[model samples]
Target chain A: MTIKILGTGCPKCKQTVDIVNKAVAKLGADIKVEKVEDIIKIMEYNVISTPVVVVDESVKIKGRVPTMSEITALIQAS
Target chain B: MFDWLIYFSDWLIYDVSGLSEGSRLGTALSFFVYDVIKILILLFLISFIMGIVNVYFPVEKLRNYLNSRKLYGLEYLFSAIFGAITPFCSCSSVPLFIGFVQGGIPLGVTFSFLITSPLVNEIALALFLGMFGWKVTLIYAITGILLGTFGGFILGKLDLKDWLTDWVKDIMAKTYEKGDTVTADSINFIKELPLISREAWHIVKGVLLYIIIGIGIGAAMHGYVPENFFEQYLGGGQWWTVPAAVIIAVPMYANAAAIVPVIQVLVVKGVPLGTAIAFMMSTVGLSLPEATLLKKVMTFKLISVFFLVVTVFIVASGYLFNLVL
Candidate 1:
């Protein structure tokens, strides 16, 4: 499974990556987490805001930064 | 509440420190403790409320609508309001600026969003409320919005398409217009509570240091920095102070978060409210980095014009505030 974090590497976007990565580690899953910074690529997912999280090709969250608990839960279900 | 705080300060200074309450050390300590507790609490509440409010604005949907439509009179107003919620800085704002232009939104509306988003920010509001109270904060916000709206309206009216870089102008010609109806997901506030709290917490943490430093500086200046540090500009109602403040701030640029404390210190150290506000608006509105980023899309002529217009507006706002407040 793959997780995509969308943002142009703002401070909050960086925090989102760290949270998602830590969640993946705790689950002991070999899932790959990627940073999708390109605006066109992000818009392709129909996302309007930065720091969006995409799990397995489905749009999950956007705009606001998610906490560790929220990230772990979103990823675990995926 | 203030009485309680006053009593607490007196007790701490007289009973704990054995220092006379009239001493400078006593006053500084009291001011420091009272301000820190009060401001931090205010910051927490305001952030929480703003977080709750932010959930209602479907920004992507709003942007999608702005991109697709050709709003004439209302465009500037909507764009200015939307700018308040956009989560972007100068660098990150570039991609979105490109997207807006490519989507066929007018250059002026885009400029409105770009200008007000950073100028009248939540962080700035929170800090200002913590330090200067709501009345001054309200005036600052109103001026910021007006600047965005009015500046954008005039710029858009000029229709300076030729001033934009060739690539941006080319993108403006592209016809990838989406439909008008924006089917945003129905929002549920209860479900968003967790995110709201987390967002508020992050905001509180982000500016915790600024508040500490701001209050620290205010505390130090409370009894230290000579009361008449700015005396030369006071007695005669220094009419030139506002413009002078803007000139000083233009070269030494900083964001609201970093400079707000400095602004607080300036006000505490005898600078007029109008002068302080003018300096702040200059910092936010005409920063060198923002100008550089805008230069990507704007010509030298338009860029220089934008700065010139915004500076005049800021200086005017300062003088107006001095006259009224």
Candidate 2:
């Protein structure tokens, strides 16, 4: 499974990265967490806000950082 | 409404601390205490209420609404109002700006949103109401809206589409694609309280330092500066001071929360209300970091034009306020 974090390098995006990594580590998941920072690439996702979490190609969250529990739940569900 | 707070501050400083009522230290500390408590309460209340409102009426819906409507130029007003309500961080502006442009919103309308989003917001509103009286707050809010409306209208007429950077132009030329929309979950106010509270607390924590430092400087000025110190230099009669204040403020970026308290003290020190407000607006509205971010989307010429137009309006409003108020 793959998780893509879309942002333009904002502080919140960095926080989102940290939280997602920790959540993945805790859950012992084999998910590949990738960061999408290019503006054009981010726009391709059609998101106006940053720090979006895309599980596979579907956007799970956008515009805010999700909690660890939320991330773990999302990973397990996906 | 805050008489109890005033009374409590007086008692704490004069009775409990045993400081003389009129002493400089006593006056400054009291001012600090009253202002800090009052502003914090107001901030939390406003943030909580606004958070609830934002959740119910998502900004994405508003953006789509603005894009789909042709409001006979009243869209500028609506866009400015939208800007005032949405609470995106400054760094996220570029993406939002591109989104608006891609969504077929007029350049001017988008400009209106960009101009007012940072300048007039709930936090600024609460700060203004807490520090200054409602009358000043009302006037300031109206002026900010008007500034965005007029500033955007003028920019829209400039036909500066080519002023956008090549990368933006390339993106604009591409066929627009609509992203998947997140459907709002059913209303559950009971479950939403925690989220609302977290948002409110987040806002308060974000500006806590600014509030302290701003009020700290204000308290010092209140205690030590002579009543006429600022007035003597930046008096209402000085035509140059208004423009000078705006110019000086353009490069120095500070949020409204930090600047408002200092502005209140400046007014108390006898600086013209108009001049002080102009400085506050310019400082909050125009900044080097925001400009650098915009470079990703707009050419240097367009950015300069945007700044010049806004600066002129701020200076004009400053003069108008001096004449009327």
Candidate 3:
């Protein structure tokens, strides 16, 4: 599964990626995480608020940083 | 071809031409000009964008939504969103805050807007992405919004009705921009172009001064300051440094966009990212002007809460960055 962060590379978006990686590593799960910083492509996701988290092409979280445990739960539910 | 000319000249004087110690004076002069030009451009660009954001964005609508409390975290979320787009310096946001309060907006929600406005913005976002890459930028944005939301909510719960200044209360009772739609106000594109140009010009006119001020200070720090002093003293080792830095920074404001480059320089000189970030938050997010302006509307007690909320957020963010980033 792929986890993509959508935003024009602000600090919050960067933290989300870091937290996600840690969560994924903690779970011993192999998932690809990408930081998408291009504004035009981020707009395509129909996201106005930034630091959006997209898992498998569907946005899972928008405008908020999810906790590591919350992210682990999200990945498991997916 | 044009780019190569400037590059070649710079190389020739600094590297190739290799004038002995006698020509060091000339090289230093040229270097000063270069730094001055860069700072000027940055200030001009940021100020221009500020004007556009002020003129264009439908902020009153957003203010209304935040005031209405239509969603649980929605106001906080939107406050973050709008905050990013409109890059107002800490002092500049005070007038807007007064406007928001007078529009019947809740103080807590307005506080959220105030908190996020300085910490996260388009220019800073772009600068962070360009300098530190995507990961660092994302973390700053998310944490900034969270702080704003939490701070706003806490202030809302406090309900300090008596804390407001009498003049501000009077201003709140008076209506100024009634029934005026943000977009409905027609600007004469032809005449306004010059006016916009003039505003842009005036904004840029002081660029040389700001650049001189920013770089004179930055270069001295670059040249004179010990490389590991910040890291060893405040960032990595000292537990109290985070809160201290936040407290120290609130009274001294500098635009985040301008400060990022300085932070980048600091980090290069071995300053810890956490400490640098705390300083950045303080300098941009809280300043003497903002506190003085807030005094116009809020009593000392309310101002105390406001400072407490922001200072805590800055400290938390610094520690969070230390742990995560």
Candidate 4:
């Protein structure tokens, strides 16, 4: 599964990247995590806020950093 | 409402710490303790409530709503009000600004959101309510909303579309003219409580240091500064003080949480209430970093014009406040 994180490189966005990585590692999931920082690409997602976590091109989180457990639950569900 | 906090502060300072009542150090510490506790409690509660509201009324939904209809100039007011409730870090403002413009929201309406987002928010509201009471808080809130509304209206009327950088103009040309439908996920309130609480606590954690520093400065001024210390310079009669305060504040940047408590002390130390409010508004609303970020989409001319318009409104509000309050 591919998880794309979209943001404009703000601190929260960077932190979201770290948390998502840790969540993936903790869950022992072989997920491909990608960070999308380009504004034009981010706009394609139709979200005004960031950092957004997209699982298979579907938005799961936007505008806030998700906690570890929440990320795990999301990964598990997906 | 917080008499118990006052009593506890008094006991802690006088009985526990053995500081004599009414002494400078004693008074300062006591004031600090009382204000810190009161403001913290208020911040947590208000943020929690606002978090719930945000969960229900998501920003994407609001953006779509704004984009779908023309509010007959009430859009400016709605934008300003929307900006007040939706919180995001100022660093992320560029993307959001671009998104609004790309979504076909008017540049002027987006300006309203940008102007008031930082100047007035739940943290500022809670701090103001805790320190200045409801009357001042209500006046401040109303004035902030009006400042954004009128400032944005004037900017919108100017038709500064050509002033945008070519990059933004390019995007504007290509993108569709309205916001797309945003699907909001449905979750029961009980199931969302943890997320809401986390968000609220996250906000509180983010601003806790600013609150402390702000209230610490306030306490120091409260205890040690002689009466009329700032009155000599920023007194109500001085016509230049209002504009001067706004100008001085424009370049410096601090969140409203840090500035509000200090503003409370400034008013107490004989700075005119209007002048202090102007300073707070300018400091939070306009900043060098934000200007730098806007350089992405706006030319230097547009940025300067944006700053000048907002500054004038803030200065005018300062004078109006001085006259009325």
Candidate 5:
């Protein structure tokens, strides 16, 4: 499964990346994490703020950072 | 109404039954505790609500819509208003500015958006309401919006595209090479209650320290600063205080959330509302750090012009408020 994290490299976005990466590592799941920073790309999802996570093709989160537990649950759901 | 808060804080911070309860230290402790709670609650509640609202207004769509607008004034106004929701620090804002300029939105509209980002944000609004009440927040927000709208329109009319970095200016030159919009893996916000809660939690964690420190400073100042020290000198009647406030604040770097309480102290100590707000806006809107960071995407001339315009208006705003409010 592909996990997309949307951010503009702001501090919150960076934190989300770290947590999501850790969650992916701990789960030992075959998942791809993509960081979307381009404005043209991020807005296509109708996201105004950064640090959003997308599980597969669905936007699971936007605008706030998620904890490792939340990240794991999101990955499992998708 | 807040006596219980003060008393509770006094009991916690010092000898509650002692004569020192009426002393400066005691008063400062009480003020700090009362204000800290009030500000944090306001910050958390308002930030959560704003986060929810932001989901509805993505920046990319806003840019495309602005590009399509033939009405320059309306476009600028809309862009300026968008600043209220586009929650990016100055560092991230430059990228968005580049995106808007390349996306065929007018430079003025993009500039308005950039300028408004610091001025009309939830942080600033919450702090203003927490310190000075709704009236000042409304005025400050309106002034910020007007500054962005008018400043951008005039700059747009000047056609200063060449002032941007050659690369950024060339993006405008290559305007017709627009890329097709990409679709995202999307989920409905309504079904994402957990995500929403996480978002709120994140905001509270991010800002809690700033709120405490700011309130702490305000409380201490209210309690300990010598009486008539600020009011006698920096008070509303001082002709030069407003301008000086802006000048002093322009170099410091702090978000609106962290600095509001300090500004509150300044106002309470007899500094005029206009001067205090001018300091707030200048510090948040025209910091040296922000200017230094923007150098990556903008040319010296454009940066100078941007700074000059924002500073002049902010200083003027301070004086106007002092005179009228």
Candidate 6:
């Protein structure tokens, strides 16, 4: 599984990344977490909001500063 | 007052002449070069400082404390002062605003902080004093504080307290956990300064256009704005001019440091310094974008009250300036 966090280096994006990391850890998932900070590439994923969580090529969440549990559930379910 | 005009006219011609000297292209190049240098330096300093504050300051604790009480009157005054210290811009300030409402801080008090936080501050005051003079800076500071205080107070009194968006309240209930106060482990202050300085430079570079636009507007106002318009319309002689100025300022967004040059021009051009200041304060403090951002968290009535209270204070300050200054 691949988890990607998209943002422009804002605190909220960072928080999302952190949450996703912990969630992946707890789930013991074979996931590679990637962070994308480039604005153009983020838009390519059809996301207009920063701090987006993308699983594989599909967007899981956009424009929110999500919590740890939320990220965990979303990741495990994915 | 009339005598001051002759002196101002003489000064204006002197500045314009200096700007116009040399081949037109050469002069324009030099002006752009100088502007770029200055803006780069200023922006770097401001953003770096803001970054340092973001990284180190106890912002969350203070924000939480401010929201913990419904001390509307004193909170307004506190919010004005506190807003100056917090480095949140129009965009970055929203999440904290969500934090404010979640902590049960009154809408009016939060608005006070929101109004003052963007419009006036130490960095801006320093720049104003450096570019203009202390007297103008003093007037700007006083007016800014008055706007925040009175705006908050009046908004608190409005009966539309329950007008916040349901999503805001719902979101607060779900994910409003506090961050750990582990700032001691963060980078040391001395080490952070250089990093902050660099970022501030970046910001200055990015927003140089805002400064130029502000000054360019001032230059035109100085050169134009018709000498008799102020006395005929917005001067101390007119009662409605104060509110009119406030209304005019709302739709526009003018950064406080950038607006000084224009305010100076408007003041010299026979626009009552008070009315001009009111216009400046209103635009800077209660900008349309800022209000729109608030809409994400607040309902329409609360937002309307936010605008109205700030406008009332700005108009009052305009009248006050005419009487005092």
In terms of TM-score, which candidate is stronger, 1 or 6?
1
Interface RMSD for model 1 amounts to 3.8
Q: Residue A48 error for model 2, in Å?
A: 1.3
| A54-74: candidate 6 lDDT, tens digit per residue | 888777765455567767887
lDDT per residue (tens digit) for residues B229-316 in model 4: 9888678488999988888887667556778887888888888888888888888888888888789889999999999999889999
Query: Which residue window of length 10 is worst by lDDT in model 1 chain B?
Result: B176-185
TM of each candidate vs. truth: 0.84, 0.93, 0.64, 0.93, 0.83, 0.67
DockQ of each: 0.35, 0.60, 0.01, 0.54, 0.24, 0.06
**lDDT string, candidate 1, B174-202, tens digits:** 67555223225677878888777778778
The C-alpha interface RMSD of every prediction is 3.8, 1.4, 12.7, 2.1, 5.6, 10.5
Clashes of each: 0, 0, 17, 0, 4, 8
- Model 5 misplacement above 4 A: A1-9, A29-78, B1-27, B175-189, B236-239
What lDDT score is found at residue B298 in candidate 4?
93
Model 6 lDDT per residue over B1-325, tens place: 1244434433444464454445444444444444334434444555565566655554555666675666646878987777765654565455556656656667777777777877675446544554446698787886687677777666767845578787766655664455334334656778756645654554565456767776566555644577766565545457777788778767767465566566666666567777777877776777777677668667888788777766777787888888887
**What part of the reference interface contacts, as a 0 to 1 fraction, does candidate 6 reproduce?**
0.00
Error of 5 at B76 (Å): 1.4
Which digits, one per residue and each the tens of the lDDT, describe model 3 over residues B103-175? 6777777888888887786455555664566687787777777878888878878887668877667766776
Residue B172 lDDT in model 3?
Answer: 68
Candidate 1 docks at the CAPRI level of acceptable
Model 3 TM-score is 0.64
lDDT-sorted candidate list, best first: 2, 4, 5, 1, 3, 6
Question: How should the candidates be ordered by DockQ, best one leading?
Answer: 2, 4, 1, 5, 6, 3
lDDT of 5 by residue, B102-170 (tens): 677778888898888887766777779878998998899899989999888878888887778776665
What CA root-mean-square deviation does each model show from the true structure? 3.4, 2.1, 19.6, 2.1, 4.1, 9.5
- A1-78: candidate 5 lDDT, tens digit per residue: 998988767788898899999999999999999998765576565444456788886777655677788889988876
Which portions of model 4 show Cα errors greater than 4 Å?
Answer: B18-23, B175-183
The window of 10 residues in a row where model 5 chain A has the poorest summed lDDT is A40-49
Proportion of native contacts kept per candidate:
0.19, 0.41, 0.00, 0.41, 0.19, 0.00
